[model samples]
Target: MSRDQLVTLAQALRELGGAVPEPVPSGAREDSSFSGGRARKISVSMPEDLSAAVQQRVGRGEFSKYVTEAVAQRLESDLLAELVGLLDEEHGEVPEDLVAEAEGAWPDVE
Candidate 1:
Protein backbone atom coordinates (compact mmCIF):
# COMPACT_ATOMS: atom_id res chain seq x y z
CA MET A 1 0.00 0.00 0.00
CA SER A 2 1.03 3.58 -0.55
CA ARG A 3 2.13 5.64 2.45
CA ASP A 4 -1.02 7.76 2.27
CA GLN A 5 -3.22 4.67 2.16
CA LEU A 6 -1.46 3.24 5.18
CA VAL A 7 -1.89 6.50 7.06
CA THR A 8 -5.57 6.61 6.18
CA LEU A 9 -6.03 3.03 7.30
CA ALA A 10 -4.30 3.74 10.59
CA GLN A 11 -6.45 6.82 11.12
CA ALA A 12 -9.64 4.89 10.45
CA LEU A 13 -8.54 2.15 12.81
CA ARG A 14 -7.74 4.70 15.50
CA GLU A 15 -11.15 6.34 15.13
CA LEU A 16 -12.67 2.94 15.77
CA GLY A 17 -10.50 2.79 18.94
CA GLY A 18 -8.10 0.15 17.62
CA ALA A 19 -4.94 0.11 19.60
CA VAL A 20 -1.87 0.79 17.49
CA PRO A 21 0.51 -2.15 17.33
CA GLU A 22 3.59 -1.55 19.40
CA PRO A 23 6.83 -3.40 19.95
CA VAL A 24 6.63 -6.48 22.10
CA PRO A 25 7.69 -5.86 25.66
CA SER A 26 10.84 -7.49 27.00
CA GLY A 27 10.65 -11.30 27.22
CA ALA A 28 7.49 -11.47 25.10
CA ARG A 29 7.27 -13.25 21.77
CA GLU A 30 6.67 -10.89 18.85
CA ASP A 31 3.63 -12.84 17.68
CA SER A 32 2.33 -13.81 21.10
CA SER A 33 -0.90 -11.96 20.54
CA PHE A 34 -1.67 -13.93 17.37
CA SER A 35 0.33 -17.17 17.55
CA GLY A 36 -1.74 -19.61 19.57
CA GLY A 37 -3.82 -21.39 16.94
CA ARG A 38 -3.14 -23.30 13.75
CA ALA A 39 -4.23 -21.41 10.65
CA ARG A 40 -7.67 -22.35 9.39
CA LYS A 41 -9.36 -21.81 6.08
CA ILE A 42 -12.75 -20.17 5.75
CA SER A 43 -14.93 -18.81 3.00
CA VAL A 44 -16.69 -15.46 2.91
CA SER A 45 -19.10 -13.79 0.54
CA MET A 46 -18.59 -10.29 -0.73
CA PRO A 47 -19.75 -8.12 -3.58
CA GLU A 48 -17.91 -8.78 -6.84
CA ASP A 49 -16.51 -5.27 -6.88
CA LEU A 50 -15.35 -5.46 -3.26
CA SER A 51 -13.65 -8.80 -3.85
CA ALA A 52 -11.95 -7.42 -6.93
CA ALA A 53 -10.77 -4.40 -5.02
CA VAL A 54 -9.23 -6.55 -2.30
CA GLN A 55 -7.54 -8.78 -4.83
CA GLN A 56 -6.09 -5.77 -6.61
CA ARG A 57 -4.59 -4.50 -3.40
CA VAL A 58 -3.15 -7.81 -2.26
CA GLY A 59 -1.24 -10.45 -4.15
CA ARG A 60 -2.50 -14.05 -4.09
CA GLY A 61 0.16 -15.01 -1.52
CA GLU A 62 -0.85 -12.18 0.78
CA PHE A 63 -4.63 -12.45 0.44
CA SER A 64 -5.04 -14.58 3.54
CA LYS A 65 -2.88 -12.23 5.62
CA TYR A 66 -4.85 -9.25 4.42
CA VAL A 67 -8.17 -10.85 5.34
CA THR A 68 -6.85 -11.95 8.72
CA GLU A 69 -5.67 -8.43 9.51
CA ALA A 70 -8.96 -6.93 8.43
CA VAL A 71 -10.93 -9.34 10.60
CA ALA A 72 -8.69 -8.65 13.59
CA GLN A 73 -9.13 -4.93 13.11
CA ARG A 74 -12.92 -5.22 13.07
CA LEU A 75 -12.97 -7.44 16.14
CA GLU A 76 -10.80 -5.01 18.10
CA SER A 77 -12.94 -2.12 16.96
CA ASP A 78 -16.10 -3.85 18.14
CA LEU A 79 -14.54 -4.65 21.51
CA LEU A 80 -13.47 -1.07 21.97
CA ALA A 81 -16.95 0.20 21.13
CA GLU A 82 -18.50 -2.25 23.57
CA LEU A 83 -16.18 -1.15 26.36
CA VAL A 84 -16.89 2.52 25.67
CA GLY A 85 -20.61 1.84 25.73
CA LEU A 86 -20.28 0.11 29.07
CA LEU A 87 -18.33 3.03 30.49
CA ASP A 88 -20.90 5.48 29.23
CA GLU A 89 -23.69 3.48 30.79
CA GLU A 90 -21.95 3.40 34.14
CA HIS A 91 -20.72 7.00 34.18
CA GLY A 92 -23.59 8.70 32.37
CA GLU A 93 -23.15 11.23 29.58
CA VAL A 94 -19.90 13.08 29.28
CA PRO A 95 -20.03 16.84 29.71
CA GLU A 96 -20.00 18.94 26.56
CA ASP A 97 -17.15 21.13 27.75
CA LEU A 98 -14.98 18.11 28.37
CA VAL A 99 -15.76 16.80 24.89
CA ALA A 100 -14.96 20.17 23.38
CA GLU A 101 -11.73 20.35 25.30
CA ALA A 102 -10.74 16.93 24.12
CA GLU A 103 -11.43 17.89 20.51
CA GLY A 104 -9.49 21.10 20.90
CA ALA A 105 -6.52 19.23 22.31
CA TRP A 106 -6.48 16.92 19.31
CA PRO A 107 -7.61 19.34 16.65
CA ASP A 108 -6.24 17.26 13.80
CA VAL A 109 -8.35 14.26 14.74
CA GLU A 110 -11.77 14.02 13.17
Candidate 2:
Protein backbone atom coordinates (compact mmCIF):
# COMPACT_ATOMS: atom_id res chain seq x y z
CA MET A 1 0.00 0.00 0.00
CA SER A 2 1.01 3.58 -0.50
CA ARG A 3 2.14 5.67 2.48
CA ASP A 4 -1.09 7.66 2.27
CA GLN A 5 -3.15 4.46 2.46
CA LEU A 6 -1.13 3.30 5.44
CA VAL A 7 -1.68 6.62 7.16
CA THR A 8 -5.43 6.43 6.46
CA LEU A 9 -5.63 2.89 7.82
CA ALA A 10 -3.68 3.83 10.93
CA GLN A 11 -5.97 6.79 11.50
CA ALA A 12 -9.04 4.56 11.10
CA LEU A 13 -7.68 2.05 13.58
CA ARG A 14 -6.89 4.80 16.06
CA GLU A 15 -10.43 6.14 15.65
CA LEU A 16 -11.71 2.67 16.56
CA GLY A 17 -9.49 2.75 19.70
CA GLY A 18 -7.42 -0.16 18.39
CA ALA A 19 -3.69 -0.53 18.87
CA VAL A 20 -2.25 0.30 15.47
CA PRO A 21 0.78 -1.79 14.71
CA GLU A 22 3.93 -0.26 13.28
CA PRO A 23 3.90 0.23 9.54
CA VAL A 24 6.03 -1.95 7.32
CA PRO A 25 8.96 -0.11 5.77
CA SER A 26 8.62 1.06 2.21
CA GLY A 27 9.85 -1.53 -0.35
CA ALA A 28 9.53 -4.34 2.21
CA ARG A 29 7.78 -7.50 1.02
CA GLU A 30 4.21 -7.07 2.22
CA ASP A 31 3.68 -10.74 2.94
CA SER A 32 5.62 -12.78 5.46
CA SER A 33 5.98 -16.57 5.63
CA PHE A 34 5.11 -16.56 9.34
CA SER A 35 2.45 -19.04 10.30
CA GLY A 36 -0.83 -17.76 11.68
CA GLY A 37 -0.34 -19.50 15.03
CA ARG A 38 3.06 -17.95 15.61
CA ALA A 39 3.15 -15.05 18.07
CA ARG A 40 5.19 -11.87 18.09
CA LYS A 41 5.55 -9.56 21.06
CA ILE A 42 4.83 -5.86 20.62
CA SER A 43 3.84 -3.06 22.93
CA VAL A 44 0.58 -1.19 22.49
CA SER A 45 -1.27 1.55 24.30
CA MET A 46 -4.97 1.68 25.13
CA PRO A 47 -7.33 3.54 27.41
CA GLU A 48 -7.16 2.55 31.07
CA ASP A 49 -10.88 1.90 31.28
CA LEU A 50 -10.87 -0.25 28.15
CA SER A 51 -7.86 -2.15 29.42
CA ALA A 52 -9.53 -2.73 32.75
CA ALA A 53 -12.73 -3.96 31.14
CA VAL A 54 -10.84 -6.38 28.88
CA GLN A 55 -8.77 -7.63 31.80
CA GLN A 56 -11.89 -8.07 33.89
CA ARG A 57 -13.45 -10.19 31.13
CA VAL A 58 -10.44 -12.20 29.90
CA GLY A 59 -7.99 -11.71 32.78
CA ARG A 60 -4.44 -10.51 32.27
CA GLY A 61 -3.06 -13.86 31.12
CA GLU A 62 -5.31 -13.99 28.07
CA PHE A 63 -5.04 -10.32 27.16
CA SER A 64 -2.76 -10.72 24.18
CA LYS A 65 -4.88 -13.45 22.58
CA TYR A 66 -8.03 -11.41 23.10
CA VAL A 67 -6.48 -8.36 21.51
CA THR A 68 -5.16 -10.42 18.61
CA GLU A 69 -8.59 -11.80 17.85
CA ALA A 70 -10.17 -8.35 18.10
CA VAL A 71 -7.62 -6.82 15.76
CA ALA A 72 -7.99 -9.64 13.25
CA GLN A 73 -11.75 -9.15 13.22
CA ARG A 74 -11.37 -5.42 12.69
CA LEU A 75 -9.02 -5.93 9.76
CA GLU A 76 -11.43 -8.39 8.16
CA SER A 77 -14.28 -5.91 8.60
CA ASP A 78 -12.26 -3.16 6.96
CA LEU A 79 -11.38 -5.35 4.00
CA LEU A 80 -15.03 -6.29 3.50
CA ALA A 81 -16.01 -2.63 3.62
CA GLU A 82 -13.41 -1.82 1.00
CA LEU A 83 -14.66 -4.62 -1.25
CA VAL A 84 -18.21 -3.29 -0.94
CA GLY A 85 -17.07 0.16 -1.93
CA LEU A 86 -15.31 -1.22 -4.98
CA LEU A 87 -18.40 -3.11 -6.01
CA ASP A 88 -20.52 0.00 -5.58
CA GLU A 89 -18.16 1.98 -7.75
CA GLU A 90 -18.24 -0.60 -10.51
CA HIS A 91 -21.91 -1.60 -10.46
CA GLY A 92 -23.71 1.23 -8.73
CA GLU A 93 -25.60 0.74 -5.46
CA VAL A 94 -27.15 -2.58 -4.55
CA PRO A 95 -30.87 -2.65 -4.95
CA GLU A 96 -32.95 -2.34 -1.79
CA ASP A 97 -34.80 -5.61 -2.36
CA LEU A 98 -31.51 -7.48 -2.76
CA VAL A 99 -30.20 -5.86 0.41
CA ALA A 100 -33.41 -6.73 2.25
CA GLU A 101 -33.16 -10.31 0.99
CA ALA A 102 -29.62 -10.54 2.26
CA GLU A 103 -30.69 -9.10 5.61
CA GLY A 104 -33.42 -11.69 5.87
CA ALA A 105 -30.94 -14.43 5.01
CA TRP A 106 -28.43 -13.24 7.58
CA PRO A 107 -30.22 -11.19 10.17
CA ASP A 108 -28.18 -9.19 12.67
CA VAL A 109 -27.61 -10.67 16.07
CA GLU A 110 -28.44 -8.81 19.27
Candidate 3:
Protein backbone atom coordinates (compact mmCIF):
# COMPACT_ATOMS: atom_id res chain seq x y z
CA MET A 1 0.00 0.00 0.00
CA SER A 2 1.03 3.59 -0.56
CA ARG A 3 2.55 5.59 2.30
CA ASP A 4 -0.39 8.02 2.17
CA GLN A 5 -2.90 5.21 2.55
CA LEU A 6 -1.06 3.78 5.56
CA VAL A 7 -1.35 7.02 7.51
CA THR A 8 -4.98 7.32 6.60
CA LEU A 9 -5.67 3.84 8.00
CA ALA A 10 -3.80 4.51 11.22
CA GLN A 11 -5.87 7.61 11.89
CA ALA A 12 -9.06 5.69 11.22
CA LEU A 13 -8.07 2.91 13.65
CA ARG A 14 -7.04 5.44 16.31
CA GLU A 15 -10.31 7.27 15.90
CA LEU A 16 -12.17 4.03 16.50
CA GLY A 17 -10.00 3.09 19.48
CA GLY A 18 -8.69 0.02 17.66
CA ALA A 19 -5.21 -1.33 17.20
CA VAL A 20 -3.37 -0.88 13.95
CA PRO A 21 -3.18 -4.14 11.98
CA GLU A 22 -0.24 -6.09 10.68
CA PRO A 23 0.29 -6.66 6.99
CA VAL A 24 -0.92 -9.94 5.63
CA PRO A 25 1.53 -12.58 4.51
CA SER A 26 3.10 -11.73 1.18
CA GLY A 27 1.11 -14.24 -0.90
CA ALA A 28 -1.99 -14.56 1.25
CA ARG A 29 -5.33 -13.36 0.03
CA GLU A 30 -7.39 -11.03 2.20
CA ASP A 31 -9.22 -13.30 4.58
CA SER A 32 -12.97 -12.75 5.01
CA SER A 33 -14.27 -15.16 7.61
CA PHE A 34 -16.80 -12.44 8.42
CA SER A 35 -17.58 -11.05 5.03
CA GLY A 36 -21.14 -9.76 4.91
CA GLY A 37 -22.23 -11.59 1.75
CA ARG A 38 -22.12 -11.33 -2.00
CA ALA A 39 -20.84 -7.83 -2.73
CA ARG A 40 -22.71 -4.98 -4.37
CA LYS A 41 -22.09 -1.27 -4.55
CA ILE A 42 -24.22 1.74 -3.78
CA SER A 43 -23.42 5.40 -3.40
CA VAL A 44 -23.87 7.63 -0.40
CA SER A 45 -23.16 11.30 0.13
CA MET A 46 -20.55 12.71 2.47
CA PRO A 47 -20.27 16.29 3.61
CA GLU A 48 -17.66 18.34 1.77
CA ASP A 49 -15.97 19.13 5.06
CA LEU A 50 -14.99 15.48 5.51
CA SER A 51 -12.98 15.50 2.30
CA ALA A 52 -10.33 17.80 3.73
CA ALA A 53 -10.08 15.65 6.81
CA VAL A 54 -9.64 12.50 4.74
CA GLN A 55 -7.15 14.17 2.42
CA GLN A 56 -5.07 15.44 5.29
CA ARG A 57 -4.28 11.89 6.31
CA VAL A 58 -3.98 10.51 2.75
CA GLY A 59 -1.66 13.12 1.33
CA ARG A 60 1.11 12.30 -1.15
CA GLY A 61 3.58 9.64 0.09
CA GLU A 62 1.41 9.03 3.14
CA PHE A 63 0.15 5.62 4.20
CA SER A 64 -3.28 4.68 2.88
CA LYS A 65 -4.06 1.93 5.38
CA TYR A 66 -6.89 4.07 6.70
CA VAL A 67 -9.08 3.34 3.67
CA THR A 68 -9.46 -0.34 4.41
CA GLU A 69 -9.77 0.18 8.13
CA ALA A 70 -12.40 2.88 7.71
CA VAL A 71 -14.46 0.82 5.30
CA ALA A 72 -14.34 -2.19 7.58
CA GLN A 73 -15.33 -0.10 10.58
CA ARG A 74 -18.23 1.56 8.80
CA LEU A 75 -19.57 -1.76 7.58
CA GLU A 76 -19.21 -3.31 11.00
CA SER A 77 -20.93 -0.35 12.63
CA ASP A 78 -23.87 -0.54 10.25
CA LEU A 79 -24.22 -4.28 10.73
CA LEU A 80 -24.12 -3.94 14.51
CA ALA A 81 -26.74 -1.21 14.39
CA GLU A 82 -29.02 -3.42 12.33
CA LEU A 83 -28.52 -6.34 14.64
CA VAL A 84 -29.10 -4.22 17.72
CA GLY A 85 -32.31 -2.77 16.40
CA LEU A 86 -33.60 -6.23 15.71
CA LEU A 87 -32.54 -7.71 19.04
CA ASP A 88 -32.82 -4.80 21.49
CA GLU A 89 -36.16 -4.19 23.19
CA GLU A 90 -35.89 -0.43 23.05
CA HIS A 91 -35.04 0.10 19.42
CA GLY A 92 -37.69 -1.64 17.36
CA GLU A 93 -41.44 -1.13 17.07
CA VAL A 94 -43.83 -0.93 20.00
CA PRO A 95 -47.53 -1.51 20.69
CA GLU A 96 -49.85 1.27 19.50
CA ASP A 97 -51.20 2.22 22.95
CA LEU A 98 -47.71 2.16 24.51
CA VAL A 99 -46.42 4.31 21.71
CA ALA A 100 -49.24 6.79 22.14
CA GLU A 101 -48.81 6.90 25.90
CA ALA A 102 -45.07 7.40 25.63
CA GLU A 103 -45.49 9.99 22.92
CA GLY A 104 -48.16 11.93 24.78
CA ALA A 105 -46.94 11.61 28.34
CA TRP A 106 -43.19 11.26 28.06
CA PRO A 107 -42.56 13.00 24.73
CA ASP A 108 -39.89 10.44 24.02
CA VAL A 109 -39.73 7.96 21.16
CA GLU A 110 -38.74 5.10 23.40
Candidate 4:
Protein backbone atom coordinates (compact mmCIF):
# COMPACT_ATOMS: atom_id res chain seq x y z
CA MET A 1 0.00 0.00 0.00
CA SER A 2 1.05 3.62 -0.49
CA ARG A 3 2.43 5.55 2.48
CA ASP A 4 -0.51 7.94 2.42
CA GLN A 5 -3.01 5.06 2.48
CA LEU A 6 -1.15 3.43 5.37
CA VAL A 7 -1.13 6.69 7.27
CA THR A 8 -4.87 7.08 6.66
CA LEU A 9 -5.51 3.54 7.89
CA ALA A 10 -3.41 4.17 10.99
CA GLN A 11 -5.32 7.34 11.72
CA ALA A 12 -8.64 5.58 11.29
CA LEU A 13 -7.52 2.81 13.66
CA ARG A 14 -6.44 5.44 16.19
CA GLU A 15 -9.82 7.16 15.96
CA LEU A 16 -11.42 3.79 16.66
CA GLY A 17 -9.39 3.47 19.91
CA GLY A 18 -6.81 1.10 18.38
CA ALA A 19 -3.09 1.40 19.01
CA VAL A 20 -0.81 2.43 16.15
CA PRO A 21 2.97 2.64 16.34
CA GLU A 22 5.06 5.69 15.62
CA PRO A 23 6.87 5.58 12.27
CA VAL A 24 10.21 3.92 11.78
CA PRO A 25 12.94 6.08 10.25
CA SER A 26 13.64 5.94 6.51
CA GLY A 27 17.12 4.58 7.21
CA ALA A 28 15.90 1.69 9.30
CA ARG A 29 15.08 -1.75 7.92
CA GLU A 30 12.65 -4.04 9.71
CA ASP A 31 13.79 -7.67 9.87
CA SER A 32 10.69 -9.51 8.72
CA SER A 33 12.52 -12.80 8.10
CA PHE A 34 10.31 -14.42 10.70
CA SER A 35 7.40 -13.89 8.38
CA GLY A 36 9.42 -14.84 5.27
CA GLY A 37 9.41 -11.34 3.78
CA ARG A 38 11.15 -8.00 3.88
CA ALA A 39 9.58 -5.08 5.73
CA ARG A 40 9.48 -1.42 4.69
CA LYS A 41 9.41 1.55 6.98
CA ILE A 42 6.67 4.13 6.64
CA SER A 43 5.26 7.00 8.62
CA VAL A 44 1.98 6.67 10.51
CA SER A 45 -0.10 8.94 12.74
CA MET A 46 -1.63 7.70 16.00
CA PRO A 47 -3.08 9.10 19.22
CA GLU A 48 -0.85 9.50 22.26
CA ASP A 49 -3.25 7.69 24.58
CA LEU A 50 -3.32 4.63 22.31
CA SER A 51 0.43 4.73 21.91
CA ALA A 52 0.91 4.84 25.65
CA ALA A 53 -1.48 1.96 26.17
CA VAL A 54 0.37 -0.17 23.63
CA GLN A 55 3.73 0.68 25.20
CA GLN A 56 2.38 -0.30 28.59
CA ARG A 57 1.35 -3.69 27.27
CA VAL A 58 4.23 -4.52 24.91
CA GLY A 59 6.85 -1.92 25.80
CA ARG A 60 8.23 0.83 23.53
CA GLY A 61 10.55 -1.49 21.62
CA GLU A 62 7.73 -3.74 20.45
CA PHE A 63 5.29 -1.05 19.40
CA SER A 64 6.06 -1.33 15.70
CA LYS A 65 5.92 -5.12 15.80
CA TYR A 66 2.55 -5.00 17.54
CA VAL A 67 1.09 -2.66 14.94
CA THR A 68 2.58 -4.68 12.10
CA GLU A 69 0.88 -7.86 13.33
CA ALA A 70 -2.44 -6.06 13.74
CA VAL A 71 -2.26 -4.60 10.22
CA ALA A 72 -1.27 -7.98 8.79
CA GLN A 73 -4.27 -9.62 10.40
CA ARG A 74 -6.59 -6.93 9.09
CA LEU A 75 -5.21 -7.32 5.60
CA GLU A 76 -5.65 -11.11 5.76
CA SER A 77 -9.25 -10.62 6.85
CA ASP A 78 -9.86 -8.22 3.96
CA LEU A 79 -8.40 -10.73 1.51
CA LEU A 80 -10.60 -13.47 2.91
CA ALA A 81 -13.68 -11.29 2.54
CA GLU A 82 -12.77 -10.51 -1.04
CA LEU A 83 -12.27 -14.21 -1.76
CA VAL A 84 -15.67 -15.00 -0.26
CA GLY A 85 -17.31 -12.37 -2.49
CA LEU A 86 -15.68 -13.87 -5.57
CA LEU A 87 -16.76 -17.34 -4.56
CA ASP A 88 -20.30 -16.22 -3.99
CA GLU A 89 -20.42 -14.54 -7.40
CA GLU A 90 -19.07 -17.59 -9.20
CA HIS A 91 -21.09 -20.16 -7.31
CA GLY A 92 -23.98 -18.95 -5.20
CA GLU A 93 -23.64 -18.49 -1.44
CA VAL A 94 -22.80 -21.57 0.62
CA PRO A 95 -25.86 -23.31 1.96
CA GLU A 96 -26.85 -22.21 5.47
CA ASP A 97 -27.05 -25.87 6.54
CA LEU A 98 -23.47 -26.49 5.38
CA VAL A 99 -22.32 -23.36 7.17
CA ALA A 100 -24.03 -24.51 10.34
CA GLU A 101 -22.45 -27.98 10.01
CA ALA A 102 -19.01 -26.44 9.43
CA GLU A 103 -19.43 -24.24 12.46
CA GLY A 104 -20.40 -27.18 14.56
CA ALA A 105 -17.41 -29.19 13.29
CA TRP A 106 -14.96 -26.35 14.03
CA PRO A 107 -12.93 -26.91 17.15
CA ASP A 108 -13.63 -24.59 20.06
CA VAL A 109 -10.48 -23.22 21.63
CA GLU A 110 -10.18 -21.62 25.01
- The runs of at least 3 residues in candidate 3 whose Cα sits more than 4 Å from the true structure, single-residue gaps closed, are 1-49, 61-64, 89-110
Q: How well does candidate 2 match the true structure in TM-score terms?
A: 0.61
- The segments of candidate 1 whose C-alpha lies over 4 angstroms from its true place after superposition are 1-37
Better candidate by lDDT, 2 or 4:
2
lDDT by residue (12-37, candidate 2, tens digit) is 65555556555433422223221223
- In each prediction, how many residue pairs overlap at the backbone (N, C-alpha, C within less than 3 A)? 0, 0, 15, 0
Error of 3 at 94 (Å): 14
Candidate 4 clashing pairs?
none
2-110, model 3: which lDDT tens digit per residue? 3334445555554555454542223211333222233333454677778567768688533234444566556556444544454444445666998687789976545
lDDT of each: 0.59, 0.61, 0.48, 0.61
Better of 1 and 3 by lDDT: 1
Poorly placed runs, candidate 4 (over 4 Å): 1-34, 107-110
Ranking by lDDT: 2, 4, 1, 3
Report residue 32 deviation for candidate 1 (angstroms): 11
For candidate 2, the per-residue lDDT at 5 reads: 60
Q: Rank the candidates by TM-score, best first.
A: 1, 4, 2, 3
Q: Choose the strongest candidate by lDDT.
A: 2
